[model samples]
Target chain A: MDISFTSLLWGFLLIIIPTYFLHHYRTGLVKDTLIAALRMTAQLFLIGFYLKYMFDLNLWWLNVLWVIIMAGVASQTIIKRTNLSLRQMFVPITIALICSVAIIDIYFMGLIVRQDNLFETRYFIPISGMILGNMLSANVIAMNTYYGVLRRERTNYLFRLANGASAHEARSPFMRDALIKSFNPTIASMAVMGLIALPGTMTGQILGGSDPDVAIKYQIMLMISIFASSLISVLLTLALTHHKIFNKYEMPI
Target chain B: MIQFNNTYFIYDEKPLISGFSVNIARGEKVVIYGPSGSGKSTLVHAILGFVQAEQGEIIVNNLPISPDSINEIRQLTSWLPQDISLPYNSVRDMILAPFEFKANHSRKPSDQEILAEFDKLKLEHNLLEKGITEISGGQKQRILLLTTVLLRKPILLLDEPTSALDAQSVDLVINYLKSLTDTTIIAISHDEKFINAFDRKLLIGQF
Candidate 1:
């Protein structure tokens, strides 16, 4: 079912059709597409080798350490995409992601699937990666929306405070705004999941030669895990960091 | 009562107010007037702990405005900032929003009280059911004033409260505010009528 190196190289021939069309139409994207294809191939090849060895070793500490690395990189991505100060957001985002991903991964491995080896690298790493990857988008949306709106409508926040609202009461609307903006896309995706598009995890599982039924079950589990992880991570990060974002007078810092 | 005891405030390393002293007594209506960016609004913000005074102290009702006491002081004072930013909710929700806070939960205004204040401010009772965006600027300004009155705080800091009002509505609002003899009022305004109605007027950017 897998293509060898020669077959994969032969697959490169298919790119000529799109490249010729792009060049003829002056789309200006042929170079970018080719470079992106090259980068993807290189990165995936490197990771394939790395993951093979790591999975072979299958040490618990290694799995945990790898997940921490993933969380760290995810935190960097979240901060960069949200245009927040890295120093201010890094630790909070890292802690939030780690706590959420670990909790969900543990629940999935130990309780839902009840694997004999709960910390098996194959089970923990991919599941944790899936959850972490999904959380990055939600975190970016929530933090960006919350801080962006707060900056734009600072007077609105202060007006609420001037009306005798406590800090929590004053901030509740913005928090609700962030949560709704971030969660709506995921919720919409969930509503149309199997009918409109086959989810990534299910497709990957089927490609890896698992039974279709098993792949469907895994996809549902992974989707739920992603939803739970994203919710917990965004809320926890916001709760932990909101105090630092404002001055004593509840002004945006 | 509010007192600025030799207060000093700096913005971007430039001193805006230094060794400034002013005392507003109970029930006294004081108007602060100055050119824009002359730190008049900063003075009001300083009283609320939004702008830090580099030296000296600002005392609201004899309680210093500091990080620890800001919440308590804010609860005792009602402020109408220059921007009358109202939520997109119905007029009733906007007016009743303050009561939803824990500090003011017990001080919730009755419908009759709201109606009375609305009548005094010349607001139509039917506006309560309309969204805040549906109201005119003058009407919204009056609604904001109505909210301040409903808060029933002992001290009031109003930044250009009548800037958006017409001549008649301005008079109506200023007269209604003047009638609140029990409240200490500190206002920032350029309107001669509003300033003349005050007991004292302090000019910023000079001694």
Candidate 2:
């Protein structure tokens, strides 16, 4: 059932018809979409080559190294996406993502899956990627929401401080707000997951010939992994980076 | 006591207050009068540690204002900024927000006491149950004033507290403030009526 490289090349023809229509309409997104498709194709092929070697080696240290690199990239992406200063944010975010990824991936492998070799590439790499990807989005949302509200309503924050609130007390509401805003989308999507859309990992598992029951179980476990990792990463990043965002007088930076 | 010794403040690289000096003994009610953009608000904020004086020292009760001392200084002063941005929740919540802080947690007022103060300030008791957005700006200002006074801080720094209020409410507030004979009041105000109630008037914008 797998498509060969020749068949995949033919698949490019299917994309060209829509791209032609887009060009005719002067949508101006034709170049961007074509570029994006080309990038995706090239990047996936490169990763495919790298991952083949990675899996063949199956060295625990190498697997851990791969996950660490994934976490580093996720941290950088989160900072870049939020338009925050990377120099101020990247280190804390990397620490947070790495800590969460290591803990969650270990829990998933050892306790949940009960694997004898926890760092086996087949289970570790893809699962770690899922957790890091989800955590990346959550961290972006949390940072943006927290800083946005603080910046916009800075006077309100100071007013609270002037009225006898300690800095921690004053920031409680903003912290709660940011966490809720960050978790809301994930929670809502979880609520309607199967009815609205089959998740990609679950679909991929089924398409790859796994039994439906086994695929569903893995899907549930992965969702929990993603949720826990996201929560841990965001909270840790926020806590570790709080000092950077506020001055000594507790003013919003 | 509050003292500003040759304080210099610059906003956006332009000097707003330069070589400014002032002194007020404890329990004195001083009103700073200035036109818009004259840095009167900035002067008040500097005392509250919201704005820093670029040069010279701002001393309250003989203690200089610094990052380490700002919290303690602020605890002794309640500053009401010109822009009254209250939480859009029940009026009671907005007023009680300060009390929830550990510093003031023990000073949480009874509902009866809060309602009585609201009545005195011309704020309706029903407004306490309503959302803050339902109230007028004057009501919000008075609620903030009420919250400040309830803290019973020794020093009060108010920025145009009566700017949103009517003549009658202004009189009520001025009188209530006047009755606090031992409290130090440093206010920024333009209303002739409110200014007349203060013990001393400092005219800014001379620079």
Candidate 3:
């Protein structure tokens, strides 16, 4: 079912419409768009070859290592996107991502999928990647909102602390704001999922020859896992980094 | 209950308060008055460990203001900062927030007690139900003042507390604060009425 090179080239031709609009509107996005498309194609092809080889080999340790690598990359991306200090944030975020992804992957592959080998390459790698990728966006939004509010409303925090609030109590309001902001979009998307949009994971499975019924069930479980992993990772990252980011006096560093 | 011994504070690489020395006794109401950027606010904040003294030490309730004793010091004091921006929908929520803290759990004021303070501060009973955004600047200031008073802390640090209040409201606050016989009050204010009402006055940045 793979498309031939000629057909793929035809698919690349579809980018011309967007390029024409960019040029006509003087949006200055033509070069950026073309470069991004080229970069995406190159990266996907490289991963495609790597995954093909990995799936054929199907070694447990290799699969675990790959998932760890994905989590590391996702953590680094979250730190960079949030514009937080890498030295302070990288380890905590990486640890949080790895731990949360491992929990969800185990629950999905062991209990639900019931694979003879829990670390089966096909189930382990893709499922972990999906969870990590979804979590990256949520962590970025949550961290940004949390730190932004704390920084902007510093006086409010100090007011609470001076009025006899513990450090945890003072930070509760900011944490509430972050959680609400990060989860609202996901909640809305989940509510209108089937009616408004066919999710990317479900569509990919259906196209890959999975039965529609099976694909739908997988998609449902995936949505739940994404939400769970995101919540756990966001909380973990905040907890792990809290001491580092605050002074002994409970003021933000 | 508060001592500053030759304390120095630096902000932005410049000495803001240099070699300052003061010993405030318990139950004394002291007023600090000076021009803007004179470090008057910073001096009060030093006691809370919000701004550290660059060269000297501050002691509150006989405890040195350090990381180890900061929580203990804060638990004994209530600070109403110059810039008050609370994250609460209604005035009552803001007033009640501090009581929810574990440190202040035992000091939760009764509704009657809160209403009495509200009346003393000239705030109407219905003001508590209004959203914070719906209240005026003066009302917001009084409401914040009421919260600090309700904590019943032994030390009160007020920074320009009456800046937004009218003359009548200012007198109400001054009289209420003056009546606290066992509380040590350290305030920064430019209001002549507020300055005159204090038991003693210290002009900062003069030396």
Candidate 4:
């Protein structure tokens, strides 16, 4: 099923269509898009080779170490994308992602898949990557929304606090707003999932020669794990980082 | 009772309030008058620990305003900020919102008590059920004032409470506030009538 270099070069030719449209429309994104596509190709090729070697070795500790590295990169990406203070957010976000990914990995591989080795390369790496990828976007949306709402609605928060609300009570509204905003898109996509769009995991599995029934089951479980992990990680990140963002009087510093 | 003893506040690396001192007795109704940018509101905010004094001490009800005592100080105070944003959909929800907090749960007002305040504030009975967006600014101001009143806290801080009200509504509000003999009322206002209605007037930033 391996595509030769000649076939991949032909695939790269498709970029001309986007480049032409971007240039003709005066969008000024042609250079940036070209650079981005090149970077993507290079990065994926490197990862493809690396993953091949790691999978061949199939060492459990190596698999765990790779997942930990993924969690760290995901945490850093979330912080950078959300425009939060990395020094304040990095450890909390990293710990939250690690904890959530570990929980889902244990539950999925141990109980559900009934695999003897929970850290098997095939089960551990891809499952952890999928869950972490989903969590990265969810945490970005949640942290962005939470901090944005808190800043925009400072008066509302102060009003509640001045009128005898505890810090938790005053902050609950912002938390509620963040949760709703972050989850709405995910929930909507879940609702229309197989009907309008074939999800990536399901499509990949089907193309990879997995049975349709098995692929759908895996997709279902992956979606559930993603939802759970994202929720747990977002709550944990907020809980851990709350003191860093607010002062002793529960005011945003 | 509240006391600001030789307090100083710095904003934007400048002294907005320096060496300012004031003592408000229990059950006193005091109005603070000053020109714009005189830090009048900041003075009241210091009581609730929203603005920390760079120097000196602030005492509220015998407890110093500090990180440790701010919650207790706020629990005893009800504040109406100058600019209002209604997070609730209806007036009734806004009125009951503060009471829903655990700190204020014990003092939750009854329906009759709320209706009584609505009557006194000259707000219509139907307005309670109306959407917050449907109410006029004056009505919104009165509704917020009513909420603070209903809290029955020992200290009340009103920042520009009558800015949106008409002369008649202002009179009604002043009269209602005058009736609360046990509350320490510290109001910031430029309205001559509002200043006259209070028991004492302190001109801030004259120096």
Give per-residue lDDT, candidate 4, residue A160: 94
lDDT of 3 by residue, A141-169 (tens): 99999999999999999998888988899
Residues A15-50 of candidate 1 have per-residue lDDT tens digits of 989999999999999999899889989978987898
- Quote the chain B TM-score of every prediction: 0.96, 0.94, 0.96, 0.97
Q: What residue runs in model 1 are displaced by over 4 Å at the alpha carbon?
A: A6-37
Q: Please provide the root mean square deviation of candidate 1 (C-alpha atoms, Å).
A: 2.4
User: After TM-score superposition, what is the CA distance of residue B205 in candidate 3 from its true location, in Å?
Assistant: 1.5
Per-residue C-alpha lDDT of model 1 across residues B1-207, encoded as one tens digit per residue: 888999888988998888999888899888999888789999988887778899999998879888888988888888899885766678888888878889888889988888999899888888888887788988888888888878899888899999998889888988998999999888999898888887799999853
Docking class of 3: high
Q: Between 2 and 3, whose TM-score is larger?
A: 3
- Writing each residue's lDDT as its tens digit, candidate 4 over B5-123 gives 99999988998988988889999999999998889999988888888999999999899988899998889999999997968899889999999999889989988889899999878
Candidate 4 chain A: worst 10 consecutive residues by lDDT?
A: A177-186
Residue B37 in candidate 4, Cα distance off native in Å: 1.9
Between candidates 1 and 2, the TM-score winner: 1
Error of 2 at A176 (Å): 1.6
Model 1 chain A: weakest 10-residue lDDT segment is A240-249
TM-score per candidate, in order?
0.94, 0.92, 0.95, 0.95
Kindly give the stretch of ten consecutive residues in candidate 4 chain B with the minimal lDDT sum.
B198-207
lDDT (Cα, tens digit) per residue for candidate 3, span B1-207: 999999989999998988999999999999999888899989888888888999888999989988999989999999999986776899888899999999899988888888999888888999978898999999999889988988999999999999999999899989989988899999999999999998799898764
- What candidate 4 gets wrong by more than 4 Å, as runs, is A18-32
Clash number for each model: 0, 0, 0, 0
Error of 4 at B17 (Å): 1.1
